[model samples]
Target: VESILDKENFTLEELLDEEEIIQECKALNKLVLLDAHYVLNSLMFSLRDRAQVEQLLRYIVEEPSEDDDSKRTFKFPFIACEIFTCEIDVILKTLIEDEEFMNLLFSFLEPNRSHSALLAGYFSKTHQEVLRQLVDLIGITSIMEVLVRLVGADDHVYPNFLDVMQWLADSNLLEMIVDKLNPSCPPEVHGNAAETLCAITRNAPSALATKLSSPSFVARIFGHALEDSHSKYGLVHSLSVCISLLDPKRSAIASPLMHYFRNQHMYEPPIPVNPETINAMLPKLGDLLMLLNVSSDEKILPTTYGELRPPLGKHRLKIVEFIAVLLRTGNEAAEKELVGSGTIQRVLDLFFEYPYNNALHHHVESIILSCLESKNDAILDHLLHKCDLIGRFLQTEKQPILSGDNNLPTLPAAGKHAPRAGNIGHITRISNKLVQLGSSNSCIQAYLQ
Candidate 1:
């Protein structure tokens, strides 16, 4: 043991020699074959030269494989991880200023690359002060790609990545991400850009809110994306960001969609939401809702299918929740737009389709409750008559009320109100208010009665 220790105890000068250290690193089959700490110390000492640092970073970013002509496969990334684990500040200070080194690190973010995890981990440990400097050199898109890869590549939780995400938000990277979500961009690029925005809004919501204080930029970008049929891949993630940002309790920022819905009449030419876009998105949202309301029986399949499916429950719930937020905002124009767009009917269809989903029931009920509470005669008339929403509710209860009966029939308590009794009571109270408001003429009262 003493002899082995003695052999490993090389002086810093000997280890720092570029050719000698590279040869030693190349000789190792695995990073564990050498003393990682010693290799890291040597690399740090050799990082004074910009060319050497870039060279070392390039080596670290590439993975070891037999097919490569360059036989250098020492797992320098593993050594870099060791350095990051111990002296990230020192190494970042040395490399962060080097545009070439930063670009080399950014280059590893290509989706096909295997070493992204290591680079992500390295950047994850880097101090914000040092990381902020690399923002310009690395560019926002590259930084977002790095973050998207970091979150996607590893199953393990990385709390440090949250700090990096916050820094990005504070540095105003949202607009860049939104800009990248263009129809012309590749699906993967759009997906990454959208995913990055979702992650930032989720992990650093307050920072994102502060950065997106006006909401116009994000709104316009998402609106355009939402209107484009080719952007389906990006739309899901963009919707997620919208959901997070518009959450009144969780998000401090107001959504531009919400604003648009509230004041759409103010625009000369209304936003053109193509029927094609609506048709494409509505079903996706509906399918997500149905998937969320999956029965317990759905979880146990008889066959060992090609692969077990992931529960679409959460995403489904998220879509409904987003709609619920819009309704709860009490924006009359928004509510009217939703009704006109058939979103209200779709939500009702989902509500009736999934009878046993408590979460779905709650969100759908909230939308109803918001509409009733708005007390806008036009809106209420639309809900009660035009959409025949009350008839749908009666159908859901399976109890048809007579047109002129003074007494309402006893609704079945079991399926009718088991998961949503409060919703029933809310409807009853609102129906009475509508009757008093005179919007409930004989035609409307017939459904409520």
Candidate 2:
């Protein structure tokens, strides 16, 4: 096996075990991580003899064709990429800390480059602390702009770009992409921006929650979706970032986001829960509800799922989930505006209107459970006086089985996707919670009675 930082003529591939995957004599990083002794000492070992840093860069930059093959070029890119993932602290720090080396590393990403995905893994491996240093070396705006340009410059580069974005996201520097989310920006930029944010949200929601926690940031995210509902991709991903941030259980390390008014439970929201953001989102929800509540002859759904139609079905699902969070989280300005909007009825309407989709039911149930658990007088009043809470539940009760559709609320009914074991069911459980809460509150008690 090759030694770290060894100047004694050695091949980088030797650093990895002889018979593991990806290429027999090559290193697979997952296996490298398991080398406890190597990981513990790899950093110190690299520092003792730093020359290997330059050696790895040569493999990455040259990225030679497979045939000509010098000893290092044979599997050079693979070897360098995998090694960087090992003792990440040592190799990544060495690459990014030195401005000259950093520039060489980035050269692998120059426009029209081939084999970018592997090269991107190299970029993604750089430590975020290096972000500040690199930013100082070359302005962040320029760097991201160039990177985004490189992304769209070639279709081949797109997937590879995501690999680099993972590093940028961890580094907390998505400013350019976030700004590009504005509808005012070229529509072309909007797709990439939305997707980049979507990827981050999907891959690392909690991190994104912390990274984009500003009131203004949250507001802009939803604002763009409304301004440019024209793009299905934009609206879907824009809403995705919002909905992920609202995850009640996410509880991102609240920043100044905590200074705002609290939710019903007084818990910190995943995003800032900006009053402005909530305000922007409601009209869309209001309009969507109006569409659902109406007796329209126009074809609304493609199939039994009852989603709005291409690029739109997914968007509607995200919108419902987003509203569910807002309802559960309880922003005062949001609640006051949303009260008596028939949100519960509208979502429940979606529940029965759609073909069996457990995802839709979970969100619909969230809205119902949120209202049933409400401590706010206005919400209780809305539920009892304004909306037909009891009648809706009755209409919803045992609907699938009684109608003999044989539809089960549960998906796959038997696997890990299955719900927990319980003798009681959805309506029964909600009814019980309603009864428990009504036991304590006069308004709720009156409604229950």
Candidate 3:
């Protein structure tokens, strides 16, 4: 984007290295280093020539030939956009207050233009962090105001910093954000995109649900989640976005993947997922879960001689967590699938397989608890009679510390069940969940005891 300014003109990098940016920005004396002074003086001098930033903005909006798309046209504006990111008070203050600057910036985002993609780049990993740091430096509300002042110009758009919400509601912005949540993108891109999408959802619980709940979107995201070779963060971020779509009001707060439903103070009704989407993804996700159940092993950490990673199905933790979210949201289709496909039974096996992965414990606990609380007789019947819920727990409780013992229905000669730390609480929660069922059958009472 900045080829024009690389050598022919000058680069801020040539003057001030990254580590010295803050110090240079604060050097009120301005006469610090010769290189810095020279570069700043030259850049300031050009600010008078055709109004540098304004002209660059215009250049950015121009369409380039197909072959020329890779270079040249984008040079100056991207350079200027990046420069604006530096803590340069004079340029930043002027740009923020200038109506023309804001308009020019927004103009870069006009429909059917390359500028949209260019501007979207700012939300990538690095820029996302910069925005966050800016918020920390100047609170959220002020940052929101500052964003409008710095980026938008139309009276309608700049009046409120929720300008994004307007765009999200009016046009294809939300779709673009959703598109970025795929495995093809970098993990950080997916993470930042998911965060942005979640914020938009919180602002409108059901307004955009139909768009997000589309089968294609669900399949793409879930497909990425099951991808064995993609970066873990990318998959987890996609799952996070998926959960937000399913349960818009579950927990508006963006927490860790495993902690998505925790830290809640108020009850929020779960949004209904599109039945078509649920049906489409259930079999695919269940198949993947089952594959991981068999393909993955529970070998302890390896030494320098072997693979240093956890067993193959490590991401089962994320998949299981995702399923836990679905169950917790009372997704009827999901419950039926878990029971009918024997997925819930496998998930319980997965829980014991990775005893050392305490996070998996919580996910497993959430899943079982959600099921017991669901009160769906078929699912409950499968768990109690066919799945042998009580027998499984009792077997796990009594299984000798046998090595190579992975899950229920199998116990090797010597092993340690990692769930021993919380077995008592686990049993209590099962009993509590059963009590919530409000059944007074003698067998249920005995099982509780």
Give the whole-model CA lDDT for all candidates, comma-separated: 0.48, 0.52, 0.54
Instruction: Return the candidate ranking by TM-score, descending.
Output: 3, 2, 1
Best by lDDT: 3
Over 134-235, each residue of candidate 3 has an lDDT whose tens digit, in order, gives 333232344335542332222355333444334434444445556665567765566666665555444443334455567876777677666654466766
lDDT of 2 by residue, 125-173 (tens): 5433344333332323444343333323233444445444443445545
lDDT of 3 at 445: 60
Misplaced by over 4 Å in model 2 are: 1-173, 179-211, 248-312, 398-425
Name the TM-score of candidate 1: 0.42
Model 1 C-alpha lDDT per residue in residues 1-449, reported as the tens digit of each score: 12222464543323333344444433332344235556544444444445555554655566656875433444454444334334233455456544455545645544555644645655444333334433322334565455444332221333343443345555435565576666666666665665555554444334454454244655555564455643455555556556554442333233433443443343222122223322333333433333333334233212121111222244455567667765665555566667666677666655554444456666676666566656466666667777787566556456422122112111223223223322454345444555664464554455566
Clashes of each: 3, 2, 5
**Pairs of residues at least 3 apart in sequence or in different chains that clash in candidate 2:** 2-14, 304-355
RMSD of each predicted structure: 14.5, 16.1, 11.8
Q: How much is the lDDT of residue 136 in candidate 3?
A: 32
Model 1 Cα shift for residue 84 (angstroms): 14
* Candidate 1: segments with Cα more than 4 A from true spot: 1-41, 44-90, 93-172, 176-210, 220-234, 251-317, 399-449
Lowest lDDT 10-residue stretch of candidate 2 = 415-424
Answer with 2 or 3, whichever has the higher lDDT: 3
Give all TM-scores, in the order shown: 0.42, 0.47, 0.58
* TM-score, structure 2 vs. true: 0.47
lDDT of 3 at 364: 76
